[model samples]
Target: MAPLESVRQELSQQFPCRKDQIQVLSTLFEASFPSPPTTVVHGLEATGKSVVVRAVLQALDVPHAIIDSKECITTRQLLEQAVAATRNSVHQALGTGLLHGNQIKCETVNALENHLEKNIKDVPKFVLVFDGVDRQKEAPMTLLPGLARLGTIIPNLSIVFIITVPNPRLLHLPGTPHIQFPTYSKEDMITILSLDPQDIFLERVDEERYDYGEEEASEDKAWLWPRYCAVVWDSIGKGAARDLRTFTLICYNLWRPFVQPIVDGTHGTRDFSKLLVSRRSIFQGDEALTGKIISAKPSAEDQNNRSKPTFLELPYYAKFLLCAGYLASYNPPRQDKIYFMKSTERKRRRRGGNAGGRASKHRKIPRHLLNPSPFSLDRMLAILQSILIHPVAQTGQISAQIATLTSLRLLLRTGAGTADLLDPATRFRVNCSWEYVSSLGRSVGIELRDYLAT
Candidate 1:
């Protein structure tokens, strides 16, 4: 009781805003037995799932092993790693318990089952944590169910899963209770990051200051870091790096220079307006927003490249699919048979002619100016097949490419039935502009104006 209370008091301060999770995990493990065979700890990446769980176990001084799921590429590898890690934990906790690595032979699940049933009788309550098992290379469906069943089957053992994606389908079995670590709120993030104020000038010792300036300077830095974090969140974190890890990295990268003017005595800490005006590049630069390496210094050529608008890098077929979507939206359905016969016939187009001349002089609205109309999946597919010189080997590949385009928002799925791909009439519209799609067409050596029915 004293130990649990002491650990609770200590860990609560070490990890702010995770009191509930710490309490739940502590209670579960401190009980007569950590019941229910399996406990799931799920959250978005960098939300402190792994670190919090680790802190609790270490603070409790409990026997545990955290095996990274990335290390387990196959079920055989997973089993071997699991057994070795479990045995190592038992030895660490009890000092002289459980069979050693060489003594326990496990190349398969059955061998592991035999070893566990025969040799794990004298060990204390142990927790074996698999971090990011849901993201492992081996399929979680087959791998996890078997592992969860093992936890149920084995005595004096418990399994914990730390996962990024909180999919219920993967955790639909009995006796599996999950703990969720939500994304950090603005206040919590600011509080957590205020732990260490960056050394703007790297705290150079040779640089001299006032007698009590050390104390006052420390006070000022503490005051300034939280405000800087707030400004960063308002300008960048709210839209781009919401996760703690990336947000923290970005802050560390930018902090040194952001406060250099203040350190030089040119601007006071409160003059954030002057600082923002002088360092406007930090806010508007694409490298910070586009996920370039945090500490990476951009070359002169890279800086030149950043000045240009970012181009979406798509798969070879995805470009054609997007082009077809644009054509289907702009061209009249009646002209489809004339321009693009069936999949078998060659497309008909005059060498130097484009249907752009077919527009009415007083047509109220230019086709490009009007919003795109929705076209069926079949219509887009027909246009895509017609435009290509060679027939695609399989439509499964095409369906996948359409899904990719939809995700990138180049093609927007329309109509009310939840955008079911199984429905042949699932309609989509072009979300790109004429100039954009026209440039895309020219890149692939096709003129988009030749197919328009304006």
Candidate 2:
């Protein structure tokens, strides 16, 4: 059998929904068997790029080295890690005690090449997979090409770079041959998730907790498991990411609630199905509270009574900052506010040579419809002090509170750079809801409605 055929068969069984990517990778693997070239595999997160490559190499029985770029910050660190992985692979393959002695440092690129040549003498052809290549903060431009050129310098060395960036130009490697792994669709995700045969829906009852007439309830649970899974997928599973690992985890947690009812023999499959179709409250709470549970959709009364812990948790001054920002965004300044005016100055010319320019009407934006506007630090502080019931004494403490708010992302900086907050160029904009603003005002014993235009 050809090498590519062998790899294709292994890939089809191990990794599904990746037929095209497997074909591309098998060809690359076949090409690298005789002599290797630098290959870059790029894709989005959770697309299974690393998994496919690892499966292919293992199936082909090719000795490979692995390096995580997050750990390798500098050129020297990259060289050291590469040399270490190479040594470990050699030790495992030949059953040699080559790694037992004192560590010999390989800090430079030349030293790395010499070390590779020495260790890989027995095993001539192998691959080096560098995961997270974009994570290298320094020397990526220099390090990538250098690693690629190692294939040419060494007789049978191939280098593969795994990156999350889809665009090649961002990494400054326009000439590198690349293969992309696309994100999976919802149907594809469902097909992949079904491959797992674990009895996730089976409910095992504890003998000590409660004793019933029946010893086990597998028949009842077996019937309802499929329906419960269908309801869960329709509700939130369709919107989730396409990663198989995450999808399987969600499936397990979603099935946990259905387990107890089946085990205790309190509810059967038919009852559960009716509740799911009528109320659709599976996502709201656990299975025990299915009947007693209210709809996940909130009513007007619920919205009014909703306790915003995030709003209530803020410092006193931060609430004032939010109130000030709301006022600044919705209300126009006096110089900017224009109305009908009678002046004694010279008449301005119109296009038809009229006596005065036509009056342009200024429109005021609705208070509720307004967005949070950027306010200077001094302006925000002034408003804060005026609205605050008790006066704040220290200037340093006020500055500290502003820093705290900025760190918590309640007060976002609106300027171009991270300049000092007190800098005249620096500004801030509050990012919160109108409901939250009013609630904060009420907690401070002030009615924010009075601040808005009628």
Give each model's whole-structure lDDT: 0.77, 0.67
Task: Give lDDT tens digits, candidate 2, residues 1-56.
Answer: 44577669778877888988888777666644563457889888888898898887
TM-score, candidate 1, is: 0.61
Which segments of model 2 are wrong by more than 4 Å? 1-7, 30-32, 170-176, 197-230, 240-242, 258-261, 264-275, 284-454
Q: Can you write out model 1's per-residue Cα lDDT over 1-454, one digit (the tens) per residue?
A: 3578788878888888888988988888874555558889998888889999998888777778888878778766777787787776776677775554363446665677666655456666677888988877756456677676667788777889998876666755765788989989988888899888765445643435444355666777788789889888888888878688878877876887788787787887678788878976776664665555464576899889989766677788888888898989987798888777764766565433336866445535557788899999888888988888688864588878888887888888777845476467788888998887787777787887777765
What's the C-alpha lDDT at position 72 in model 2?
76
Local distance difference test, candidate 1: 0.77
TM-score of 2: 0.55
Name model 1 segments beyond 4 Å from true: 31-34, 97-107, 204-209, 290-454
| Residue 353 Cα positional deviation in candidate 2, in Å, after optimal superposition | 54
Q: After superposition, how far is residue 59 of candidate 2 from its true place, in Å?
A: 2.1
Backbone clashes (count) for model 1 = 0
Give TM per candidate: 0.61, 0.55
Best by TM-score: 1
